[model samples]
Structures are given as C-alpha cells and as structure tokens.
Target: MALDFTTTQWITIGAGAIVSWLLLKWITSPSPKKFTVKVPEAADPKWTGKVLENPSIRDPSNPSTIVCYDPSTGYLIDTVPNPTVEEVKELYNRTAAAQVKWAKTTFEQRRTVLRSLLAFVLENQETICRVDCRDTGKTMIDASLGEIITTCAKLRWTIDNGESVLADDYRAPGLMMMYKHSKVVYQPLGVVSALVSWNYPFHNAIGPVISALMSGNGIIVKCSEYVAWSSKYYEQIIKTCLSVNGFDPDLVQFVPGFADVGEAVVQSGVNHVTFIGSPAVGKLVQRNASDYLVPCVLELGGKDCAILLKDSDLVQAIPVLMRGVFQNCGQNCIGIERIIVAAEIYEKVVEEMNTRIGKLRQGSILAEGEGVDCGAMTMGNQFEKLEALVQDAVSHGARLLRGGKRYHHPKHPSGQYFEPTLLADVTPEMDIANIEAFAPIMVIMKHQGPEDAVRIANLCPFGLGSSVFSADKKLAEKMCMQLKTGMANVNDFAVNYLCQGLPFGGVGISGYGRFSGKEGLRGLCVPKAFTTDRIPGVKTPIPPILDYPVQSAKKGWSFVSALNNLVYNPEVPAKVGACVDLAKANI
Candidate 1:
C-alpha cells in the first residue's frame, strides 16, 4: 500500500537524518586532551627564560590576551599577555643600544656568534622540530627539513662566506685620476626590524638574523602572534647561544606581538626593515617604511605555477609535482597553486594526479608516524578561505577532480584537515585560479600550445616562482626563461629557492629586494665609497687641474685626450707618442 505524506514532513525527516549522521560521525572519532604551555607565575624565581619579564613589563589594563591553539586538534595550547605599545618601544630602545655594541665587534667575533647558533640548532634539532610542529601543525619531517636543517645551513653559510662577501672592495683609480684610490666599504645599517610570518617561522627568522648579525647589524624579530610558542622557544635557544659566545643576547631581540607592535616597530626609527607576509600587509609595511625613509625587503604572497608540457617526463614529475602542492599543506610562499598543461597530455596527467592525490594519507599531525603525506592546516581560519575558494570555483563551472571537502578521520575529530584537492576545467577568469589559496589545493588549466601555457602562467599578478617540466631540457629552460618570476626552475620546482647561494625573492605584485644570497647579506648594509690620494711622490698643484675656475687649465683637455689615445691606439708608435705628449702637456 502506498502512503501519501506532506512534502514538508519529508523535508523535516531528511534534515533530521543529516543531523543524525553528523552526530554519529563526531561520536565515532577519537578524542585527545588539549595541549597547554605552563605560564610562569610572577613570583616564580626559577623562571630562567630569556624573554623579559620586568616589573614594569605588565600588559595594559584589561588587555586582550593572545590565546594560541594547536592547529592539529583545534585545542587551546597557551595564552600570553599581549604587549603594550610602550613595551614594544622599550624593546626597540634596548635593541638600539645593543646594535651600537654589536656594530663595533670584529668580523671574527660576529662569525663566532653565528657559528655558535649553528651548533645550537644542530644539537637541539629534534627538540626544535617538535616545538615548531606543535606551533605550526606541520609534519615533523617538514619542520626538520624546512626549519632545523635550513636554519643551520643558512647560519653556517653566512659564517663561512659572510666576511669575504662583505669585505672592503678596493677599486683601481682611473688613469685620469691616478692619485685617487677608491674603496667600497659595506657598513651595518644599524638595527633591522624583521617582521616574521607564521608559516616557516623558524627558518625565515633565523635566516635573516644570521645575515643581519654576520653583517654586524642588530635585529629585532617580531614573531607572529598566532605562533608565539615557537618564537619563545627560538628566543630561549638563541639567547643561550649568544651568551655562551660572549655576545649580548639582546643583539637578536624577539618581541612576540600582533600587528600593532609590528606597526610600531616600523615607525620606531629602525634603520632597515624586512617583512614576510601577505601582499596587503606588505603594502602597509611599504607605506610605513616610506614615512621614516626606511627601505624594506618584502616577501609577499605568490600564485606560483607549473607548466607540464606534452613532452614532459610524467614519471619524473609526479612526485615533485605532488610535493609542490601538498608540502606544508600548501602554505608555502613558493608552492605551486596552478598547473598549465598541453591539451594533448592534460587528461592523462589529470587522471594520474587524481589517483595519487586520492591515495595520499591524512593522519595525525605528529611527525612520529609514517604514511601521512599531509597534515592539518596551520591556521584554522584558512579552512573557511579554502572552502570559499572551492565553492566559488564550483559555481563558476570548475570541476573538482578529487578531494574538495573537509577531511575527517576517526582518530582526530577536531583536527583542521583538508584532503589534498585537485581541480580541473579551471580558467583565468575563475577566482580560485587567480587567488592565492594557502591550502592543499591544485588547479589544472588546459592550454593548446607552449605559448598558450606561458600566457596562462603570466596572467597572474604574482611573479614569485614558476616551474616547467619537459623531456627536452633546452625546451624547458627556454620556457622557464619566459615565465615572469624572480625564481624559476626547469624540470624542477623550488630547486632554486632551496639553493641558499641564490637569491630567493619575488617580482611585480609579489614584492621586491633579495635575500638568501650575497645580495641579501649586503642589503642590510650601507655602502660607502672611500677615495684617497695614494700616488707616491706626487704633489698636488695649489689650484686643482679639474677645478671649476679652470679656464686657464685648457691644456688639461689635451692631456685627457692624449691619455685616452695612449690606451686605445693600436699602433705602438702612436701609443708611445701619445703617452709622451700627455706627460708633456700635463707638465
């Protein structure tokens, strides 16, 4: 017998069923206790941490506390007192004093301090990894490779190579000015305000600090408020390294605060600034720096792309291509956001990528276990952004090849995890393709030819990085050259960025200035050209030959012409005669 029911009654039943399923899903998931850091009491005499806690260092009355969370489990981790404006100013004042002393130190002394830091990082690598993992929600492997290893490598590189790079360069005086000896001297540009981003906190902060200190400049690192735990840990270790090396720990100050403190730092008369964050905030930094005439090095956002040509080696490109998007859960500045492929090979590549992304293991955020290719998103707020982008793309006729929804596991109910996602039929007109989605999402766009692929890649405003993979090395190189980016790779992704000897920065809307190379070490310095009269047994005339009132010295032009002819004249007799004439005319 068929029974008739009202449409509203069926709708109510459907909604109730959906709620029941969600409840069941939540109940079946594993639960874990929230992680928390023990805040030292005011009267605790055993608090031996390096962070300042003076009597006057209390937070403002009714100040908003900066509560931190473990992104892996969406659990409360710890809370810290938000620094007041006055406190940030005090920190800067202290760093200024420290800079004066640090600048006076010898090159060997600075190198020693840097070497000590390298040693500390190596010895405590595992501990550092755990702290960073807890703070960032990235896998242990990422923390080890990206933070521990990279930070130590940068420190060692700076120590071993910094002196020679920053050495006083002597230039030969021109024949026209024979007595003048010129020298290019690189000097420290006082204190540097390093505004660090939350992602890859350890390496980014340590990288600039090593360069700044090795170049004999003081640095005040303002760590992200969201990840203050990692900053505290780094600060403690850095202070110990500094103290043991007979240097003032304040030379590298760590001030943990939010955007307000960062703003104060910029306007507080720092000699130079280096900021790493989104382009919007970077623009603010530039505007602030302009007020004080302070130059800045900004590593802003990136919508980096990769072009998979028809002749590309799919076997070789699969792993790197996957890692390029999934690594750090796609929170990296240089991570690939879009892929342009030749239409002939596009379908095959899309299927292969879909299968691989589908097979990727989503597990606990801890680095202890194996088989987890991805971890939770470091920032919980990013989940909403990722969802919005996916929705917008779907609405605009884009198709999700795989993994567009939030990921859930029975063992981690509250974890902020997004499955590795792949989207196809993406176009330049879609918002998802244009925006920098700092999540584990990869968009594939089809192109008719190599030129079309290049056109698609260059359509974005960001020019941070681009990569191309082709069986023909020369073809790949040629294509990569046409890609507008500060760093580009042929048949590989992020290889240039990983090479510490090369400059890692961006172009156009991605921001400017360089870091991680000789240019970076020198960017924190003030170059002064020193010229001196060094010619022996030469006495200057009372009136200089090139003086303004040199109408009486009309013969000087003849001497200049003779000197020019003496150097360039091919004939031996002419050269000899010209030299003789130059000396005679000058006399």
Candidate 2:
C-alpha cells in the first residue's frame, strides 16, 4: 500500500512481521503454557459427574478441620492451619495411640473396611475421574482410569492380599539345642506423613495413602499446591468412606501449601514420611527423616525407557509406544520418554511411528466435540522445559522429525494445547533424550541389539520403570530379568497393569521404597520379633544328651533335638544385624 518507504521503517515493519509470525507460530503450534481437558465422569461403568460449580473453604478458626470438596469437581481442596512443633508432636502421639486400636483390628476388619471403600470408589469412579480431570487437566478417560481406577485397584489388591503377604515367615534351627525363631511381621509404622505430587495427585498418591491406612497408620498429607483442590476432594471422599466403613476419621488429614509448609510438617517429627516427588525434594525429605531418625519412603523422578526388540510386531509396537510416550500428555512418572528401537528395522519403525504420530489429533481438550488424543502440560514449568528441550535439540543439529513448535487447538486457542512432538536424529548425548522431559515430548533413537539397548536405556541418573516389546519368549524373559528398573514390562506399557498386587517402586533416582503390593505393608511397618517362654520363672537354655549343649547350664534337654555347632551366614549376618539395628532405631 505504500509507494515509498524508508530503510528504518521497512526494518521496523519487517521485525514486526517476524515477531507476529513467531507469536502466531507459537500460539498455533502444538505446545501451550497450560492445557485443560474435560474431566471425565467415570473410571468404570459406575462412575459419573460434572465440573464443580462452587466450593467452600474451611473456617479459619478451626483450620484443623477439613471441608468436604465435591468429587465431581475438585474445588476448595484444603485449608492449612498454623501448625507448630508441639502440634506435630501431639499429632504423632495421637497417631501412636490410634495405632494400637487400629492394629488390634483384625486383618479381616481392615480388609472389610478397605473392600467397602474400594467398592464405593468403583461405584463413584466417574466422580473420582472427573475430580482428577479437574485437578490435573488430563483427559477424563486417562485420568479416570489412571488415577481413579488405578487407585481403587491398588486398594483392593492390598485389602485382598495384605494378611497373606505378611504371613509367610521362617526360622533357622541352630546346631545343638539352640534355635533362632525368625518371623517377619508387618506392624504399622505409627504416624506417616504422605507427601503427594501435583502430576497425578488424585490417584497415584492415594496408593500409598490407602496402603498406609490399611496397615494401620495415621497419614498426614502435604498435597501439591498446583493441584491442591484435588487434595481437598480426596480428604472429603476418603474421610466419608472411613467413617462409613468404621475406621477412625482422624486416620487421614490434608495439609496444603508450598515447600515451607511441607518442611514445617516434616520437621514436626512424624513417625514415617512417604514422599512422591522430584529428586531434589526426595533428598530433602530423606535428610529430614535421617535427622529425626524417622523412616521415609522416597519415590522420586523417572526417565523410563521403552525397548523394541527385533521380533516386536511393528504394528502393535507403534501403538504401545505411542501410549507410553503420550499417556498423561507425557507427564506420567512412568512415561517412556526415550525409545530404544532395534536397528534391524529402525528406519521402518521410525517411519511407522511418524505415520501414527501424525494421526494424534491435537485439538481443544475442553471443546464439546470429540477432541484430540492428547491435552496439555499440567504445569507451566513443564511447558517451558519442553519448549527449551526442542530448541536445545535444534541448536545441537538434531533433526526435528515431527514437532518443533507449539500450538493451541484451532478451536480453543485460549486453552493449553501442545501437539505431541517427536524428535529423531537425536543422539544419546542430547540432554533431552537422557534427562527428565516431564512433558508431552518424546525422542526416538535406534539401538543395534538387546545389550546395546539396555546399555543406552540404563545410561541415566534415573531408573524407575521400563517396557520391552518383543514376541520372542527367550529375549523377553531375558530383558525382564536384566532390565534395570523396579518394574519391567515384557510386552505392555509399564503403567497399564494396576491390578497386580505388587509393590510399585523404583531404583536409583526413581525411588527408595516400594508402595502397594506386600512390600507396601512392610514399608510402613516395624518388624518386631520376640522370644518368649511360657513359664515366667523357668530359665531355659540349649541342653543336650551330650555332656554339654554348647555352653549352657539351664536344663531344657527335654526339647534338645540337635548337636552343638557353629554360626553361619558369614558377613551377611552382620550386615543383616546392622540393618535390623537401623530398622529398630527408625521405629
């Protein structure tokens, strides 16, 4: 429209055009600051709900009490009281006091209560799903199943298997008339501080929460500030469930805020602390626990891997890998951010992956129509970190095969929307490929064989979960054993099996303790072994028909059945002794 223009004016106009183009590209790209998804109504057929309309907060004067939040919509989650060391100490004392009653409750009683709660959770699965959806901004379907159903499954598994898991015990018969009666018993660790992360706050945190509760411990939770509302919803439902199921209402309580609040609560000397979070926080909690001689279960971060063997069906592998990468929009702790593809068909697999990656419909998550396969970054930091990783790869000469930009779903530009991204030609040296990209970005790399694949997969500071895809029985079995992770999948996504009544934990930077399963009970309990004699005044010692039973004088020859001998287990017995001593100190 201009007949003449100055150099400076043209420059300004050009710069503006470039800036506008960049902004538009960013706004229209697959990455958005925060994306919101429609909270689902159910984890199963019985679940249902709508977004919460308006929720109320707790009365400041009585902040120790919690206000029930709607399960349909996570609203007004928790209100923190000004907690002090004395209050914390008193809380622990009360927890200890409560444990006696709860522990005395039969395993059937605990199981009965948990079974009722499980049934209720399943019945209200939809409401729980929607609550999670509201809290995490994940797709309702994923949140419902991942958070709600998974939590319910874990609770049910623990209830069903808690007693038997603790029943198996043994003892070694010492040489001579001496014997060591060895038995492993699971007792509640008394007061446990449950620290939940923001990512999967609704469901994942509850696994340990229920586990601790079923094992007869009082759990005080420091919920994620980012999704505090969900914490409130949990307190509401769980408290009601406990009351109805005949458990103490004080068993579970919610504390809200940032690190300062968490520190204050942690420093209060709770009996045991169970934390699910990043490595930094995990270390801090561990340090605090060490100072107080309080036991803690630290479940930290993960840079999980997905291995594709030569015989893996490319068709099945593609979808499995897709879900592994994109489920929870890549925010899952077990999300397989790095894929190790076999070199025999590396290009073929990458090509197929690219084709399927294209079909992941990126759109407005909350729009009325059937939306995209994914949603957005649950946290703003995650969004920026993902964006930086893509830029870093580009700067380092790695090719961006699928996504190199951010975008809002065309219909809902205002919502957080990120196109699922794929990067190829990305070497293991690239930080994004090895570091924690806790977002919706996935980097694909090739591996020559199982040994090489495992090497690359294990080349990380974090070892949590891993999945191996192959039809070969021998290779799958080998990988399952050799894979360096707390949990390994032979032919499925690592997070798919929530019903297995096994502990879900990690190694290295991933976590230090196990949750769910049988180990879950042991993690939150003390193993107290005692040797007792029926008669109070009678002193019994190892006695034998031989001249002397080792070096004992007290007569118990009636029960002597073996000849005198020596000690064994070598240094293992000493190490075990040290561990037992440490365990006793922790309790």
Candidate 3:
C-alpha cells in the first residue's frame, strides 16, 4: 500500500510487529519438549494391581496375572499370583511325591543340590540384590548382606557340615545295658511346609528349605504375599538349579499367598511345619499344627534389647547400637527395639542417639544408588503401626527425643516413609516398651545397674536375642550368661544371628526350638533309636528282673534288693557287699 508516516509512527508499527511475532512464537512453540530420559521399565504395566485381587487367575497374554505394589511409590511392581487352595493342594501333592524320592537319595546327593543352589546364588547375586531391593523396599546393601550373601554363606555352611550333623549319633550303653550297642539315627520327616516372612524374604524363604532338604525332607516354601515379586525370581533360581542338577524341582517349591495359604499348607497333612513371623500368627501356626500333632518350629518376632553398661564406651557403642536399632529400618526380628542404658549414661546416650537420628537421611530407597540411610516401609500397616506406637508412647508420658510423626517426600509422596524416631523415659508399663516397634524407632530406658539392665531385658516374654555392650569382658560374659535369650551378643549386636554355626531361635512367647546350626540340621529329621545285643545269639532279650512274675519267691526278692542296694546304696563297702550278693544270686 502506498502510505506515508512520521518517524514515531514507524517506530510504533515496528514495536507492534515485534510484540505480535513474540506472541505467535509463544503460541506455536513445542512447549520446551519436557525433558525425560529414556529408561528401562521396572515392571510390566498390565500386571500391576491391588494385592487383594484374585491372583489365582492367569492371563495368557500377560507375563503375570497377579499383582504386587512397590512400597517406595505405592505403584504396581508386577503381579505373580499367589496359589489358590487347589494350587496349594497340588503343591502338597508335588512335595509329598518329591519327598519319597528325595528321602531315598543319599546325603551326598542332597548336598550336591544344596551346593548347586549356593553356587547359583553366588553367581546371580546382582540380580538377586536388585529384585530383593525392589520387592522389600530395602537398600541394596541390606539385600546384599542380609538376603543374598548371607543366605549363600549359610548354604555353603550347610553343604559343608550338614552331612555329619545328620549322621547317626552313637550313645554309650549304661552298665545295666552293657551287653547292647545303642545308636540314634536321623530319619527325614516327609513333606515340610515353610511359612516365610517378608522382612528378610530371601533368607527366611530359603533357610528352612536348606535344613529340610539337607535332612532329606521335601520342602514347599509359602512366600509372603506382600513380597511375591522377589519370591517369584527366587523360585525361578531354585527351580532352575534343581532342574539342572536332575533333582525334582518340586523338592523345593514356592507357593505364594497370604495367611490363608500358609494355614492351608499347615493343615494339608504336611509332616512338619516351620513358620517365621509375628508371635500372634506363630501361635496360630502352633495351634494349627497341634490339630495333626505335626511338629512345627516357630521363629517369631523379638523385642530384642540392647544393654549399655556403665563401663561401655560411647564412641564404640553408639554406632554399633544404632546399626542394631535401625538396621533394616528396625524391621528385623532380632533388631534392637529396646535399649536399657545404665543411669550413669542414660541421658548422655539418649542425647547422642537423638542427635545421630537427626542426621539420618530418609527418602526413596534405591536399588543401585548410595546415600539413602532409611527407606519406605514395605507394608502399609507397618507405617500405621509406627505412627500408633509413637503416639501411644508419647501419650503415656514418654519423651519424644526426635521424629514423632510420619515423613513425606515431595517426589515420593505415596510411599510409606517414617522418620528414625527416638523415645526416652520409656517405662516397662508403656505399650511401646512391650511391643515390637519394627520401625526405625528406638526406646530408651534407664537402669539402676547391670542387674537392673538384665532384669529389664528379661522382663519381656520374648527371648529371641539380647545384647550387652561393655568394656569389661568378664562382666559382660557374666551378664550374657544371666540373660535368658536364645542367643546373646556381647559388645556388638544382632550380628550373632548371622553366624551360621550358632543356633538361632527363641523361648517362651518368642517361640521355641532352634535353627541355623547342628540342632537345626538334626531338627529337620526324626530320631530313631537302634539297639543290638553285643552278646552272640542273645537276640530279643529283656532283663529278667523287669519281668512281671515274681518267680522263685524269696530268692527273686533277695536278688532285687541286692541290685537296688548295689546301684543306690549310700555306703561304698555296703554297696560292694550288695554287688557280691547280687552276683552270687545270679550265679
């Protein structure tokens, strides 16, 4: 267009054009291309769902029809279906069938398979750690030390020493039975049902199986439903090893489910049962086993206590005790839930603990990364329990030293995260004092002396594990001997359970029996007594003195009297004369 304008008018026209161009660019832009890095998908999208869904159903098109969630984000990880009642029945059948053949195999053959499993675990440790960390909401360090490596070490120990442990034990025949040879032989209990806990899923799942298989019993591991994903992969590894070693894969199978599935297995005519979980549930398992008179081992939860004596060095004790308290986020059954400190160091220890707890980092637990100290709670109810415990204690006059509530991260808001809570002035009457916190909560109680510390530690019904931290070795040993725990750690804590050679278990409400050592290996088998007459042609002989009839009247009475005198008389010369009389009567 042929138009004339002043210089100011031209400038106004240029500014309007610039503004319009900028507006147009903003409208038509690609919105800064929202930066996102390409990464491998963690789990199959189709299999993710609520845990309560019917996991028995399988979709042919999908990798898994069952679903489980990631605790860190409350998002679906993947579903691996728990067994239905029918499936559990099938598992029992398979286990029973496998037991027949497994029991027939020699101990060497059984040891071979166990060694193979250990080798597989050692070889696939990285994969195991990753799956464990993902499924349990624990750090890789925990999965590595607590689950994979620890289990492998146990398996190695089992393979090396299980043979002699299960061998026939010979007994010395008493003087009365000098003419007979006595021996005790171990026989396999047919099918063993192992109800594994979720906290240390890998270790708990495989531990009983090791003993059961080593003793020639077929085992079916019923995995916790909350940690089905880890179980699935673990089952795969075990089955693969079994198949490769030419043993029946059913010798050790995993049936995943909730409490119903575990109960079903217990009620399914299994020869023996082993359960590792809470005391309430352990009692249920015992009751269930009682119906059939099937012997069961219950490794229940512990309110493990740590005692810091007046002679304890704070520098040496604090880190070890904190690790004992907060390791696995205090989800460990043997973790230090209660700390009884001497009055001399109660305030100092509590103050230092609170300060140390504050320095702990809480966030999304990563499988591969470092720097995360505390992670999300694996189960939803655990978060609630932690909150309730703290509230209950605080309401009951307990002083909250640090972290009195739940924690939330901006990026991982859905996760069940809690702070490392510390409480002081906790009394025996308080609910938190008696209960297993099973979280990163430390309860501190002051004691008058070493005896008071022992008294307080022994007050709990649970006797799984207790510890004494002291600079005095002799005094600590004395305290350890006095503690009624199944196993006691002196100076350090909780690591005593990791010793493969030591027997680990509890007494009273903490449950009964032992595991992880010679007793455990032998416990998996039934004892059979064998006796044979050492004298030739003396078969089917019973002591004539024990016969019902009082034959030879006076002579028989005199012989019996003389035998009693020989065995139970107080004076030595009279006993000698009675022995001579007894021999003369026999002659």
What are the Cα lDDT values of the candidates?
0.79, 0.68, 0.79
Deviation in angstroms for 329 in model 2? Answer: 0.2
The stretch of ten residues in a row with the least summed lDDT in candidate 1 is 48-57
lDDT (Cα, tens digit) per residue for candidate 3, span 1-587:
97999999999999999999989975974321111112224532232334322122234575334456667656656667656778888888988998898899987787777767776677666667666766777776666768886797788788778888888888998766778899999999888888988888788888888888889998888898878877877777667666776788887888877678888898887888888898999889899889989898888889988899998988989998888888778888889988999999888998899889999987655532666888777776666767788888889999998896778766566666788889999988788888877888899998999889888888888889988999999999899899888888888887766678888899868889888888887877789999988899766544465466855666677787887888767899989999888776665
Could you tell which candidate, 1 or 2, scores higher by TM-score? 1
Model 2 spans with C-alpha error above 4 angstroms:
1-97, 168-170, 176-181, 363-369, 409-414, 495-499, 533-539, 542-587
What does candidate 2's lDDT look like per residue over 1-587, in tens digits?
Answer: 85798999999999999999989975864321121123333322233233224333344557554343322233333343444556555655665676667767777777766765676676766667656655455776677757876776777677667777766454453432233444566677777888878777777556666777777777777876666666666777666666776667666777656676677668765777888888988898888778778877788878888888889987777887888888877887888888888889788877877887777775423333265577655554345667788989878977677775566444444345566787876777888876788777778778889898888888877888888889897788787678778888878887534845667778888878877666767778787664444345554542233244434323222212111111333466554665554343333
Top model by TM-score, which number? Answer: 3
RMSD of each: 18.0, 19.5, 20.6
TM-score of every model versus the real structure: 0.83, 0.76, 0.85
Give the Cα-based TM-score of candidate 2 against the true structure. Answer: 0.76
Q: lDDT score of model 1?
A: 0.79
lDDT of 1 by residue, 1-587 (tens): 99887999999999999999989976974331122233222112121122221111123563556655556654455667667778877887888888898898898888777766766666667667766766677887877867877786687678668899899989886765667788899999998988988888788777878888889888888888877767777776666677776778777878777788899888777899999999999999899889999999999979999999899889998788888888888888988999898999988988999988888887644533567778777665566778888989999988887888788756666667897899998999888877889889989999998889999998899999999988888888888889899999988988785567789899988899988888998899998989877877765554354567776456777776776788767799988889887777767
lDDT of 3: 0.79
| Candidate 1, residue 53: how far the Cα is off, in Å | 31
lDDT of 3 at 460: 83
Q: Candidate 3: deviation at residue 331, Å?
A: 0.4
Off by over 4 Å in 1: 1-63, 367-371, 539-587
